[model samples]
Target: MNVLVLMLTVLNCLSKASERTFPRIVPSQLQFLEYTNLTVTCEGFFNDMIQWRVLRKDEKRNRRTSCNKNTDAFGACHIEALYPSDSGEYWCESDDKRRSERVQVTVTVTDVILESPVRPVTVGDHVTLRCIKRKKLKPSTKFDFYKDGVHVNTSSTGEMILHNISLSDQGLYKCNVSEKGFTKENLLQVKAVLLELPDRPVLEGENVTLFCRDKMAASNYTTFFYKDDEMIGNSSSGKLTLNKVFKTDEGVYKCQTSEDRESEEQWLAVRGGNSFSTSDVSGVTHFNMFYLSGLIALPVLLFVLVFIYKKYKGPPVTNEEDEAKYTALTKRDTSLYHELKPPNSTC
Candidate 1:
């Protein structure tokens, strides 16, 4: 009788202490970009007996019988194309009644999609842009490529190729397709490749020259250098020079040919004048130089002002009455000269 009672007690304790060994979905992101293929795997459990469920609103949808295919022994759910309606909490529940933690996923819908390579498009690369419906992959339909909203090319094969890509070919592209008497458009961005660069570890006060070349040789076109999207200089020789580099000169730099070909922005880092390079100072852009310089100077300026005030005003005033008056002056005026005025005097 005692053995039976102890066995029951131990079994109850074990049951109470046991938790779901696998409690999460792999690639556990709550939000996913639309049209992306997502493979959400329920990790930790080694059972093929696991079942996946997606809870949308108040309804429970089965993954095994739905649009997902079981990928492996752990019952990973794979969705080919995710749509907005697919947004919900997903989880895996084992046959033994162990339930994994639910993962919320949201899918967004868009009118068009630009299908391009993941890497930057370079010269000599035959880049192709295919516009497609975000939700479904349907039959090959006629499509047109538009640059800056103007029609450039039309193809019945649903693909437009930029052959022997050059700098002049870079622009904001959009693909348009007519379906069911309605036109759908999507945006595409093509970036130019870096052809040449100066030696690394650019030091302050040193001069450096950079050259930008297009994949194809097009004569009579001038190249313009840009720092943080602002045009710095133009050269017909495809060469741009940085004279007497300052800390302020470091920034994301790019070049565009007169043909309107823009190169990919690259970081130009300038270290202190004493050293050529430092790991901590690398990759910092000069875009915020003005703001950073003001921030650094403000505290030093305040310290100098305080020192001059203490030296000229005789012994330092420390009374509560004087402190209150000082605080009041500071609150009254935002400018340094106004704040430094005597408590009872007006400037």
Candidate 2:
């Protein structure tokens, strides 16, 4: 009984831990032009309890605030006109102290800006940086790319593409148009290792493969795979394949290289094969609840059926003595009826 309680407690914790809360940004970019609108919304199961909080660039503390005018009915906060003063870190915070990932936003009034991904890119990813100018540029315009204030490459299309980026590629990047001017420097972060898996939920009983690759293209290095902080396996090829994955196989997974470089941990969700619509981890929890309910209800159902049968159809005569007792009772009733019968008086 104690073991069962422990199992239930652990499963409940897993179920609750799987639900994620995060802030969603419209336009999905960290940098914005002055006077442009920005929208932020908290997304999760407890969105109603979440509120927008920001650490302004000039301020040392974070404070809760609403949109410039009013928050919409859907809980989205809108900044109608962004200014350089609005540049800071923004995130969602719940009343109970739960916080989401913070996003750094920059608002600039420059004539040109560099367009890049807001999030860090994995090593070996092909990344493209575009130089956007407030005014249109000529088709034959020449753009110069710089990393950390050093000229790296030049492009004619007003964009620079870095093929198979490595750690050395991560630095402050800027672009200069031939006639326009230079844009503000933007930071490019490249991770050393990346663990690859399916972005969508995997179906139970399906085979899943996870690959861990070194951004530097190292040939011989042992890779270690972990699930929920527990080591599961290792390989020289930096790949791990799980055959016929079950709900129990679902958890947070990450990989590490021989040099101790680790990738970010990601959740692996497994859903019932028959239930494609239920995509979250709660689906597995529901299945577990149903299974447990069946286990607890089966015995009671059998007991109730036996009780109803005995209450209406009577009990079975399991022994000869019981059968004899039933026969004697019937015979005695018949004899008594005969004794109580009066002699035939009708003529």
Candidate 3:
């Protein structure tokens, strides 16, 4: 019986001690996006009463608003429509105001006007959008970026980076001032680009080579070869060499290269390895015929020589005596007695 009475007395003392202890609470990192919500709470203090208080660390102003130290032993501190100046250290203290610890409260103030990410960004390019404030604020606070009403990224710094920008990136971008409740918006413009080839190109075969050469001497500029609207080959130096070509190689080929814009294309009308030769056919054909006639005439030339010799030599001219004998027999020596007798004598 005496042991039971002692145990009951000890239990009552322990309960009273538990009720008097108050829980501790602290606020972590704070942010300001034009408007900020700050909540500070106390926990674990069952019996001890908790009171919410706000104090401007720079100006030293104070407030007590936690349940007015009523039924709730733990409490919270809240400030509405927080401003840059409203930012300070706050605390949840015991109702007696004797015990306290600091709760960090942050409020962000954004620049009234922001200038960032100048317009006309090409698709697949990198871009940077910056926000500049009219007035300077505390430097320790970080900045956050948003796109098309969505959170994109944050910088523990004042600048945010966007890489490999795309068409989807085209939207209103705003910067949130994490420390001072400031926000600024800017418009984005993204352009779409296409790959293209040159207009007209003429290629002569064998003795010539075609290139997707640019009128300019730009380096690292590439030329893409196209046939019937589809790309088939790519070159850095722009030259496309065709060696030992065939009829299948004949067709239209175009090349596009890079400049500030695209370079003048070297469009090539590839001839079927022999088209160049065919173009001047009339003259070549005439010369070939002349050469063939000369070659055929070589063997017939000997027969022509033999005919000329037979006509010119032997029996064609007779000496005067034979001529006179024929004349005497046929005409009976009409010229004179001397002509008749002149088988022996020629005059």
Candidate 4:
């Protein structure tokens, strides 16, 4: 019996590894603007139990789910709500009685643009359009990107991203998002930038990083940035970066190489300021909030205390005034004293 159990364990391990070996099925094209229908198929020879999951690029872990068994040999499972976060790899387990293999499937929702023109955009321009996904993908299904009707790029983690593009990237742009196997599309106009920062831009108060990139690409074409027709200090590394920037750094900026080839002038504004006021109005307002109740209740409390004292201890009498009144009464009684005098003294 022990030997038989050991054999079963080995067989189970082998089957598990095999069931995990295959990739999940994905569609070549998806139809969006309709109800979601994301059907993911796995290679199977196993029992009815199928494992499924969704994941995000930023997440280090995956969420798990149990799948409903397909009644046919297709071994497919369907999920609904194909939102932006539902874009991820899906795996299914297929156990063939004695051996098993896993299938890994990639799910894609159709993200095609519904509102973009069929022309390539020029440089140094911006475009705006609305994106709509009809498929009922989960809130996690991200939009896929494309150019010229071909898969040129992707944004699986976010809904939108700026291209910071050049003339070389001129093509039609669209979006693809899917859910449950249903697809969505969003049309967009792609434009090239003739004058701008090519890489990530960092704006600083005292120190500014400046850049000027040409719309055309050539390894030998030197890229240079000029402010008021003056070149920056120097560059140990070829990147245009100014550390410890100042307000004086703000000015008209442009890029040029070979003196004749130049981009349009662009303005960069850098406002420099530092403050240490104990009396900023907004700050004071927040700081003095604690004193509001006490300040308001002070007069009312004084009035109440006076009323309470009058109720409990009667009215107050001044000792000096009372003494003066008693002295006057004694003076008036002095005549009686004189009448009763026994001829002793000058009454």
Q: Which one is best on lDDT?
A: 2
* Tens-digit lDDT track of model 3 for 1-347: 34344444433333432121122223233334345455455432222222433332543345433422343544554544456665555544554553333434445554433345332556667776655454455564566788887888877656776688766777877777755454545667665433232221223444334555443335677776665457777778666656654534543345566553332212232333333232344454566567778878977998899888998876555698788888778666555666567577765
Model 2 scores a C-alpha lDDT of 0.71
TM for every model, in the order presented, reads 0.35, 0.54, 0.25, 0.30
Residue-level lDDT of model 2, residues 127-163, one tens digit each, is: 9998777654445467899999999998877788999
Superposed Cα deviation of residue 27, candidate 2 (Å): 2.9
Q: If the candidates were sorted by their lDDT against the true structure, best first, what order would they fall in?
A: 2, 1, 3, 4
Over 4 Å off, model 3: 1-112, 194-347
What is candidate 3's CA lDDT for residue 262?
A: 33
Expressed as tens digits, the lDDT of each residue in 1-347 for candidate 1 is 34344444433322332122233443333444576766666432322223543222323443432324433234556777777767666665555444444445556465555554433567666887765564555665687778766788988876888898765666666566675222333323345535354535456889988888865446677888887679888888888888899978865677887666677655564656775133322223232455578889999999999999988989756699798998899876667776587998955
lDDT over C-alpha atoms for residue 219 of model 4: 44
| Clashes per model (N, Cα, C within 3 A) | 1, 0, 17, 67
Whole-model lDDT per candidate: 0.58, 0.71, 0.49, 0.45
What ranges in model 1 sit over 4 Å off?
A: 1-112, 117-124, 131-160, 166-184, 188-195, 198-201, 205-207, 214-236, 256-264, 273-347
User: Cα miss at 154, model 3 (Å)?
Assistant: 1.1
Clashes of 3: 17
lDDT preference between candidates 1 and 2, better one: 2
Scored by Cα lDDT, where does model 1 land?
0.58
